[model samples]
Target: MNNFLAHTFTKKAFEQLASIRNQYSVSIYLPMYKKGKELNEGLGQSNLKSCLKKVHAVLVEYGYDKSSVNDYLKPIRNLIFELSFWRNPSEGLAIFLDKDKGMRCYKLPFPFEIKTYVADHFYLFPLLPLFHNNGIYYLLELSRDYVKLYKGSRNNFRDIPIKKIIPKQLEEVVGFDFEQKMLQYRTGHMMYPAGSFHGQGEGKEDEKKELLSFFRKINRGVTKMISDKKAPLILACTDELYPVYKKINSYHKLWDTNLSGDPEFKGTNELHKASWSLIQYYFETKKREKLAKFISKFHTSLTTCQLSEIIPAAVKGKIDTLFVQQKEDVFGTYNSAKGCLILDSYKEMRNISLLNMAAINTFLQGGNVYFLEAEEMPVKNIPMNALLRF
Candidate 1:
């Protein structure tokens, strides 16, 4: 079971799946429920069974003999009744199969539209959010008494243990003898405990200095914990603490915007919601900036919205960025020898998805790929667009 199924989906896995080209590649996507009656009642397993049925039908329609089709789908069929496999499901399940690669399944974090595709290549546009820039980040819940670290993506968040590497509380680093009065309040509105002396201007400055020292230690620990230094780190703290932390933060990718408010009062889900909102804006801004660049170069040789031009450019590693319309498929075959693209209204035996090919090539060659709504495309009504490297 562990050999066939994967819980974590990475860009490397996506690239491997995309690189496969076969005569009877099978891609299946099923929306899964993590909780509720649907989970307990085996609805996910049932849904998978239905999807497998579709896959079997599609294989038959392609003229594979009954025995060959059954043998090809046997791996998936074994999973239909595997109760344990369905019990711990993610928001979606993606399965890819071919004669050469056997079968690989991923329980992905994002919900997917239920569909299946049997073609020369796997359908992968549904997994783009995980690969998008700003899609993954770290959220540091910073406070004097409590500290936590979370690794977050566009739709998932999980705690990353920092207790061993970092001090869990400011007292651990600054010692218990530091001014108790200063520690009582983080914001201007925070009330001093009854009978505690409320200090004047100098005390506030001292508090800042103490916090700066504590944050410096935290910054060191956080830097050590983060394997990807370029990934953004969002600070979750009150407005007052943000400036003090900023003064001490050594991380280059700390987000300019802090997750404002007292993080102590927020649950993990609340923190995820707030942080994802900020990251989404960051992602949108980047996409818009790219779109603006595309528009500026619209009439030049550096940019193009034509599928014929984009497909070959991608194959040759000439695209800097490729924009594809969401929920749309352009099936075709590309002749590398002739530098030609032939579009088909329907999927055929020899044709693959041109948009998928362009995206995969661009991504594999270190270019960016963005899936946008029809209205958000650089050129309206164009299904695909590209910014060329040369």
Candidate 2:
């Protein structure tokens, strides 16, 4: 089953969409203002938990319970929930989420940044570190869908045809069959069994030598993109191969941890952990500077301030990003203009609940939450703040 299948909830057919449509409004937020607290009573307003409750009411099967909200929502904060309503269209959802955070959620006139530089199907195989690398036929199907949806109709998000929309460019786009295309596949933790073959047992030095050679076979199999250092390579391997992969994380001047290892995927999650995979070559190195370059490339940022000092200065439009956590119980808006924000990331992290709200403020104003896979962000990893485009 596809990894996303667990998330796809099936509702009643035919009349289901109608009932849920009105139930799930496009915009909802748990105010940052604390419940029963005036805007002046505390630092922020209605919190994200309230907003997540509203989303839960709209999309999932559950009622909002204040006591349980925090525990339920804790996991979703640092992760990206890529949802495509089997019944609903993608544009409409993107529009809603984009609007919820008050983002510059504009639809592209065209994937103008991309030139349709079609690489041979085989060539697209190794770049599987970001997002799901599904069926080869499905990708071509996605291309066909893009041609149909994005090619015309003035490229409107809502009115454009979903049937025609094809996946467009982010920094980069590559294709591969997760099962058949890679030279090796290993576990994220163990790093063994590069595809159909397993390593041979040997004496201590020989075993180390063989393992090193194995990694070479895996890493040396770089595509033109990596060999020439055009864009970083996202490798595909199982969890077993991870230790081995990391042991040789520093190769002979060649490092490609852009390798994604999703054990859930049987391959490709570690290297692509978090939504970093979505970023094509963004977080691929151990070097402090190489990673800083990518994290600093974020398209959004949270605007923060001390309640006593900054609230007076934050005019409605002046603040670009506003963050709020899903279960946080905030009460009111700063003045009369802004709306509440919600963070529905379900995960664990260091003081992430606090960070989640800070992140929400960023989104409430139309910025995006820095979706992290793990709670503790590394010093070398992209700083949530650094990614802001502004």
Query: Which candidate number would show the highest TM-score if scored against the true structure?
Result: 1
The TM-score values for the models, in the order shown, are 0.85, 0.24
Provide backbone clash counts, one per model. 0, 84
Give per-residue CA lDDT, model 1, range 272-346, as digits (tens): 988998888876777788889999998999999888788889989999989888887888888999887788898
Off by over 4 Å in 2: 1-232, 237-326, 333-390
Candidate 2, residue 300: lDDT: 29
Worst ten in a row by lDDT for model 2: 135-144
Which window of 10 residues has the lowest lDDT sum in candidate 1?
A: 189-198
